[model samples]
Target chain A: MQRDALIGEPMVRLTGVAKRYGGGVIALDTLDLDVMKGEFVALLGPSGSGKTTLLNIIAGMTPPSRGSIHIAGDDMTHLPPSKRNLGMVFQNYALLPHMSVYENVAFPLRVRKLAEKDIVKKVEAVLDLVQLGHAKKRLPRELSGGQQQRVSLARCIVYDPSLILMDEPLGALDKKLREQMQSEIKRLHKTLGTTILYVTHDQEEALSMADRIVLFHQGRIVQQASPADLYFKPRSVFAANFLGASNILSTTAVGDGIAQLKSGETIRIGSGAAVINNEPVMILVRPECLRIERYDETSHLSAANSVPGQIVSSTILGNVTNHHVLIADGHTVMAQELTRRTAHDWVPGEQVKVTWAAADTRALEPDEMDVHS
Target chain B: MKETAASASHSTWITHCANAWAWFGYAFLVLPTLVIIPMSFNSTDELAFPPDSFSLRQYEAFFLKGDWLSSTFLSFKIAIATAVLAVVIGITAAYGLARSSFPGRGAIVLFLLSPMLVPVVVVALGLYLYFATLGFSGSALPIIVGHTLVAIPFVIITASSALRHMERNIESAAMIMGASPFQVFRKVTLPLLRSGIIASALFAFLISFDEVIIAYFVGRAGFSTLPVKMFSTIQWEISPVIAAVATLLTILSTGICILVTIIMDRK
Candidate 1:
């Protein structure tokens, strides 16, 4: 994609970026990216999706095989990391083992050659922001994983660069600490107004914190959208599957915005470019979006995108109960209900009717294969 | 619990036996030097263990005498110079081997470390011939150069072992934080390997200080390290002074070895 001026400011821009390893392995295919100022963008993917590679490219830690990167209207593609002036928080903390927390936080400022008073003040402020000022004199090894991560945060932001790059910075923390840091990061982003490019395999993190998420697979981004758009209107099977658990059903186009399931059941769907009239296509629907009710075969059981299935097994998740239903065609469909009260009556071996609204499903592109839920 | 206690007692007995065996193995290593120190005090000219009589004249003669005292001083200066040169060369070479990937990198590392695997006699012979033509034969400078060459592999091996465990990203992180290459090496990499660098320095010192054949092969009529001096004194005639110097060299080298071991263990 060619670069174009977008509104008033472009915080970061990557044109035709690429990375190749020693063995001629293409780690990142040619890519382009644009991050607007004050935007919090998440590069979300499964493992080896080139998410971190993209972040590294922007951070100036790793040079791209081809093309250029620009931050704050300056081309920094060929520059060394020190000249780029970008802050990065690594997954492993990367704190200097012998330095105390305050020194780690003050490192970037020291590199900037700021005066002692300015450095001390800036460091104390960032430390206070991360709520780690009380432990300023402690070494990194003395801190817990969560506290170490906060120290890393303080270091990355203390110098106040134009941008911040985080590579799974919270992956090592416990769930509670991870959530807490996520919120703290969001609050910090709001206050700093600095552009951010975060990389993670966790889709939930992307959904919870990002202004927009770029979903990557293999070495390419399959989709880019807001969290709600990705959840409610995914245009590709991979995006739908990766964002959440999705069931892909093969279907043949019938007519009037409807398609025939392989079970010979006609299903209604929304209008989209993923399919042409009378063309074979796949529909992606999430488990929670699907509905399973007690079976009543007396009415011929004909309904739009509805199938008669037997309840095979069920599990009660905290917020929802998940049911496994074996369809007449032998496909096991997953159905989740908001409450156990609605699913309690269903017993193993009992028949049930599975259905979903057509608008909730999307036409799945063949190239965009479903991600394993 | 009662059965477990009984099993613990049996295991403790086995551990005690193993500990005794460990002491026995160490005793074999220690006995030779221990015997030599006492034998150095023998009153008679011919050196003998469980001497007929003990005296301090050996140590007195060693300190107040011949080229022996001057040679010991020369050896210390050479060892010190060798240590510094070896550490600087080894650190840079090891960093290249550990950090960079290039054509012939593996071969270069093999070449650098090969000195350790080659026989000291071969190195001594090669250096002796080279020194003769280079106009450095029988000089303390040649001895220092030769010993530094021998000591470099030890420095490289130890430094590389310590450096290999360091994440390459630490350097990158320093770079990202606006550290130049020199600053990153100094502020980040060097600080992390403090003890390892000291240990490597000590190893280099010990390597040169303990060297005998190289010094013997290249020692001029008057120029000699303590080792070469002691060697000639023992061969020319039996003397307690040589034993006194020998005990000092043993103590110094063994002390350095223990120090390096301790530092490496701490790391």
Candidate 2:
């Protein structure tokens, strides 16, 4: 398959889109999003985060309560879904149970009143593209979950729509099948060069498949950036915890570039840290960034902050070992170390030191805890 | 080991007793219909069970009599019209009731199904009084309209149940793929609902065909339906032809019920 080299013009543009249901339940707050042609963007969020609602608005299935939508530079705010010329793949595949696979794939063309010959050719090509050519005569119930999803994909793309919206399309599949379909979808997106807006709650899926990830929280967009950028530098505490596992410690800024932990240890912050003196902040350290060593062996290490703690628990997870250590102030911090053939195993209640460079840690403003008094 | 064997034998005996009771229940329900079938074939003119001889004379009489045949034909026509009207109105009502949320949705559903909950004679009397004021008591329109009113509830029940089972996203998928609302209904919703609609139409036809109380009150002059005709005949005289008609109706209604059961099971 030949790839489209040039990134095309803007494919979808949403300005101040809002969706308020009856009784004043806000499914989507005022939000703006843009997708360049051929770009694969993933809406990543938990349930009730409005990612699915956002997708529905973009597909024109649900009218936005307020704001405007432009598709391919044409204002489509009031247009019905049929006028938008977009394809959507639902989570359950939603294959028409009464129709044969061939008819299901030919439905869009038939609705458009295309020539019969052209419909057959296009349907056949797309079915072959999804590798379901041999199953054309079978009904949806006769196929496996993965095959059903592929047929759904084939049906959506048969008309060569300018954009495709998929709402957790691989959610129903098992792990191995989900991974296979993810790669298959990515390959198809590359070859077809059609922009796609995917919605999923799985952070790993978004990280692996999307060109950019838009993180949503409670009906608002928290952050939108490339996967690597979001992973390495999350703008908010929610983004940091949601994207990956993080060990957060409550600390108070005591100096120009240092913070005092509750354990009374002063640690120098990295230049990249976003905090000021005398302000309460949360220090975030990735589990894998923390190294476990003996308390006495850390003296030779320079330019690294060390915390003395006791190993409370250790779990071996195939390629790495995760250890939970309790520090002086009764806070538990997690440290993950790669499992090598000759790696030493630390027993419970053994004294240990956790060390990491200042560059590996981040100090940011603390989030308001929503605790009930 | 002894206790297990003893309990197993006890359970087997219980199963045999249960099976015997089930067979007795079925016989109690169906034995009357079986008697009518044999009486329809009796060589004698009077109604009797276990006839000594058999003949098709009553079947021939049922087909050859002008009043009987015409009344049968009229009933079929009214039933077919009622079926079409009920299905058309019922589908839209079911769609609205199933897909949308409003303040009085539950109350609206209860009102639509009120005809079924009320006694059939009460509904029949109400229709008679209402149509009499309009000077339509003696016309076929009253019977057809009354039958449609009763049949609409069944159609709504069947269609709404089917709608509940359907995945709501299929319609949305069709719409997103550039199908207009009408096209989505035609190509997606209606096709998926074909069996349900057909079954409901069959129910409407059967309900109209067999309904006698409303037919008795509304049907007058020359517009009496088959059931009304049969009722009047049985009132003043005894005929084996009525037996034949009953047998035929029994078979038809049974076949339709079986078909509905099969369709429901398939889904």
Candidate 3:
């Protein structure tokens, strides 16, 4: 869907960008990235992952200690944030407390020296776009958290900036409001067709909203791909663990597209799985892909892989049920299945067998920390 | 149940005692000042509370007497100039201190606030000697300069807290919205700090208007401030006109304080 929006030259390019503090602490390591025009890219990471620092550098609020930055093919490494012609939405909404909502939205235009009549027209139109037209006279403090966020959105969009940077803009809102704002922002991105670089620590937000997700860990890019690609083909143990819950079984690659788990159980691998001989690897199986059945059952014979385990616990999550199975070598694998009225409920301590297709598993390189452990 | 009731009643009794103590404290601080109002209405030359006859005679002398009105005008002029000068210097210093981190910043702040910690008489004497060395003593300029020095620390304190409490990201947001640094300061920072700057400016004005130590130390015969004139009169004789001047000064300071409070408490 976003392919058409991604055509043309990259809107933002960072070449070997890096940041280091006075105490020799590395906030951001040297990294390169490109963001296409009109494409929404999410820098997704946990805290201290250098996502916010990268956004700040691109916004020209913080200068990179090394490397260069380009915005719309212009070198802007040394330019001040004011000269960048970008807009930013902060987590706290950062609205001018002394100004009314209308004036706050009008601030960028007023700085640009637009005619008063034109400012009024533009401000009203943008306020209406954000569904905040009636709140023109209210101060930011007078508005609810969601309303304040909308006003901030209005303020940033009123200037028609070429790019927008959002630093966890929905972080402070409740879950329902955050979901609503997520779709609202998606609609705005579609309507405006402007590039956006969003920084967030929320995996679900990045998965649902962004055209592409750039996963960061320890000041480096762990993986950069479509949400589905990252989920299905995680390149490392960290990548597999970060995106979602995965049953990672430490294994040693054997010959003939097979790997032996630590418990000495063998599993079939997909034909595309590139496994080096006698190398330590990890097999990632998502919870939703696993099938759980009674241990005595002869079913799932064609599934290509099965592991015997005891049911540790089962949790009902409204639409789906999660069953935690304790396999050999103290490895626990979670299996999720959609709740069905006719399905048998497995209780704790019940022996079960879990099965999955070879195609559903990803063979990944063990992370350095995991290898040491 | 009995113990709980006794404890609740004990807390209520403590609250009533604290309230009465607070009211008594306020009266102790305010009643002596309020007494000047009635004394200013004395009909005779003697200054007295509850005058035998109510009259504006003291006020008449205050407005018509030698150098009384002139000195008041001089005080206003000096105080306004000091307020403007002090606010400009103080807010700039406050912004610099709040926004940047550099070596020796703490020392710089200590130097700026040193005027407040030092005795006013020492500061006045230092300024008096410095100006005498420069051959600039005994002029209205010296008095204005002296008052600004003392008033600047209060302005810095007020403006610094405002800057500290302000949302720092608004400045960055404005910058990314295509506002130049100077434009951001003018359009965003200044307007956001409007109340704090105004309150501090009024504080500067009040400090300069009421300042007698520095004014007397540096004032010329032709440029005597109202407080300095009042100081001289009280030292020389007990005049009823001084009572009227004191009442006016009290009213002016109180009005400015109320204005400052209102500005600070506004949303």
Candidate 4:
């Protein structure tokens, strides 16, 4: 739906951006990025992974040590935050305790000396948008945490800035409220069509809300992609492990397109000229993609690779039961089931045969998957 | 019941000794102050702890004497000006020290607090030599300046600590929303530091108003502040009038303390 008006042009560009803190601590190292107009892009990473550093640099709160930044095609690297004209939401929901919700929302308008009627109208509109219309007369301390967060949102958006910087905006909320606010933020973004740069360490929040996710690791942008693309086609073991659970297995190439498991069982690997014969390789398959049972029941076994293992532990996660199995090679492999029908009732120490379709197994680089296999 | 009471009670001789000591301590402290208030109304020109007759002569002389009245007015001006100056400088510096981090910041903080740590004799000696070099020794200006300098560091420490727990996110949020840096500071930071600033101002005022050591070195004739004049008058003559002035100063300082407590309570 957003492809029509805004997706064609890049609204913000960070070219070779980098930042180094005091005592030679490098937060961001030569990071390059582009955010499309009207897109909600999440800068996702663990703490100290340069996500917040990127947000601060984009907000103009801090200057990059070694790169240029442009906003809507204008060079804004040297401008202060005042000139940047962006709205930001903080994790703490920093509303003024002395001010009523109405006055806090009107703060920006008052600063600009907007006409009193216009200020009133804009503040009312934003308050209604955040669903705090009834509580506008109350002070910040009187509001609940979720209500306070909504007021913070109203205050940030009343001015209608072109960009909104949110640094872990919902991170302080409990799980249920966070999920509710995720929908609220998504709905607001749909209506506003404003460029938003969100930063957070929570991967699920990033995956759920982002039009695109820029994943950072150790001061580097390890990968950037759509959630589905990052999940299914991760380029490295780091990506696979960080995004979700993956069981990587080591195999010995027996022939062209065929591989022998360390257990001496032969299975078909996808044929490619890149697949060198008799070469050692690490094969990655997601936990849920594996179908397993205590005994082999399949008649047509050629379509799938079968491995024999003993269940070490299994956890019942409502709809799915995650089984950790130990292979004959002393490697622990994880398998997940969709329903209780397959293996939820399976106890530890049960002999099991796990199988996956050959096409589902992605061969990761040897060095990247060394830890798993 | 009789046996329980005997068991709970302390030794009779020790209890009596403790009560006697407490009463004696009370008397020792109350003896001087119990005489001054009533003796201020003495009829005689010469003074004693106990007077033969009573009148309001000393009270009348307090206002009628040109030197005392002028000295009180000059002291008021100096104390007020010094308080304002010290609070402004101290609060700004303290806010900076609290909110910002830089190299040698700890040492800088210690240096600012050094005036409070050093002995008053050393401070008085330094003030004496410094004012004498400027050829303004025994003048009211040097004494006021010295007192302001000493009072400022106290204001700075109080305000800086207040600013540290200030939830810096308020300023950041204001900036994010469309307020300029100055607007954020004026509206958010200032209101939050109001209690600290008022406390600092009152404290600085009292510090300078009652100061004696530096004033002794720097105060001169024709411009003697109230405390300096009181000190000199007490040296030349220990009269009931000085005691009356001392009692008034005590009342004024007590009023300031009460005012500070009320303002802080409002916060």
lDDT of 3: 0.89
Docking class for model 1 is medium
Which residue ranges in model 1 land beyond 4 Å of their true spot?
Answer: A1-7, A22-24, A297-304, A340-344, A368-373, B1-26
Question: How do the residues A10-74 of candidate 4 rate in per-residue lDDT, one tens digit apiece?
Answer: 77889999998889998888877888888898888778888988888888887899999888888
DockQ of candidate 1 against the true complex: 0.75
- Encode model 1's per-residue lDDT on A148-170: one tens digit a residue: 98898888888777889999999
lDDT (tens digit, per residue) of candidate 3 on A201-316 = 99999999998999988888877888998888887888888998888888889976788877787888763347988987678899998999788888654746788899999999
- Which residue pairs does candidate 2 place in steric collision? none
Q: Each prediction's Cα lDDT score? A: 0.83, 0.89, 0.89, 0.82
Please give the range of 10 consecutive residues that has the lowest summed lDDT in model 4 chain A.
Answer: A364-373
Off by over 4 Å in 2: A1-9, A271-273, A299-301, A368-373, B1-26, B137-139
- Candidate 4 C-alpha lDDT tens digits along B170-240: 88778767678789889999988988899889989998888888877777658777888887888887766
Interface RMSD of each: 1.0, 0.8, 1.0, 1.2
lDDT of 4: 0.82
* TM-score (2 decimals) of chain A in model 1: 0.92
